[model samples]
Target: WTEHADKKGRVFYWNPASRHSSWQHPLTPSHKALVAAYRRIMQEEDRLAAIQSELEAFQQQVEEEVKGWRQSHAPDGTPYFYKIGTQNTRWDNPRDELMAHMDLRMKMLQELSQMPSLLEEVAPPADVTGLDRTQDSAGLSEAAALTDGPGSPVAP
Candidate 1:
């Protein structure tokens, strides 16, 4: 393998038969399958992390909204001021809807945290052991088929 960089950018060259090539080739079928599984796990991890972060932000929103409401309302929980002509209430109502949404999101975060450990269900259980980790066997088998050598579908 060889690498050359010009004013444009960097580049790499490789010969299939060369030992200790400069560039490694793409994954084989079995390797690809393993990679896919690993990707799935990583994607789930990212999603769960995002959810947790969002939940934290939403909590902050809830706090700010509640604080504003408390500040506008009187000590007795009544409106401290109203518009001169119109019956404009002063105190802001508690954000029941946002609170509810936050609650639901918290539940979703819990489920997402548990997702990686949970396995996929395929068939009826004999002893009810729960979801089977062996459910991804077909994908693994498909990837293993790539070992058939060059010109095979898995070769590239």
Candidate 2:
């Protein structure tokens, strides 16, 4: 297998059998690296999924808070309030109660963006090679068994 650099400066594995020089093609070294990377990515993906659930819960709470605020305030209030300017700005309307909600939404989005990196803290350190060790099907299953139920037979 030969490695080739693309116009965009991305390194890809090339094989004579397949016409494609990209990483997606069937190249042994690239495939191994991709598989390892994929395993590591799974943890991050699970974290993102949990973050989605958390975001949804927060959204529900925000909705409830907004609902309560609306009921207690002006009867003719807009749900979304915006500033009308590129740089200089003011509340779209003086009576808009949603400015706080918008602020909360922005905060939530920012936190959500950081969630991935935060979740990765538990991941193996960058200097630690073989974070997700390369294992064949049997080896993976064998290793996975160690974390299984109490009844699982431990290999002697």
Candidate 3:
């Protein structure tokens, strides 16, 4: 920051990098305000760090609690999780919905793999154009068979 004088000869501070001009000197009460603001920012950073530490500790506690659940398979080959300490048991797997979706996708893929790659449904007959068509007994070309009359009335 540098000091400059306006056309009227009044002392003004100018910051070339920020293109800012101030009538007050830099070392005045603005220095105290800057120091107070710096203190506030440091306090906020410390508070956020404390909050993050608490969240991490809470996450660790949850992970440790989840580790107590034991997985076992039923006689019919179905899986379940049991937490003996908490007397909690569930027949359905926690990831059952996602696994069921993946199972359906796999089944569809297997069925598609068994089909012929070039398989196609039956196509309609080729259209008979005006060329190489003999006039019918009604004196109408084969291409004129598209008439709205009954039974097409082409007479073969």
Q: Report every candidate's CA lDDT.
A: 0.47, 0.46, 0.53
TM-score of 3: 0.29
Q: lDDT of model 2 at residue 39? A: 51
Clashing pairs in 1: 29-143, 30-143
lDDT of 1: 0.47
Where does candidate 2 clash, by residue pair? none
Write down the TM-score for model 2: 0.27
Q: What residue runs in model 2 are displaced by over 4 Å at the alpha carbon?
A: 1-45, 70-123, 126-156
C-alpha RMSD in Å of predicted model 1 compared with the true structure: 23.1
Q: What's the ranking of the predictions by TM-score, best on top?
A: 1, 3, 2
The candidate that wins on TM-score is 1
- Given candidate 1, what's the lDDT at residue 3? 51
- Span of ten consecutive residues with least summed lDDT in model 2: 86-95
TM, every model: 0.32, 0.27, 0.29
Tens digits of per-residue lDDT for model 3, 42-89: 355353443344334434544565667678998998777777587776
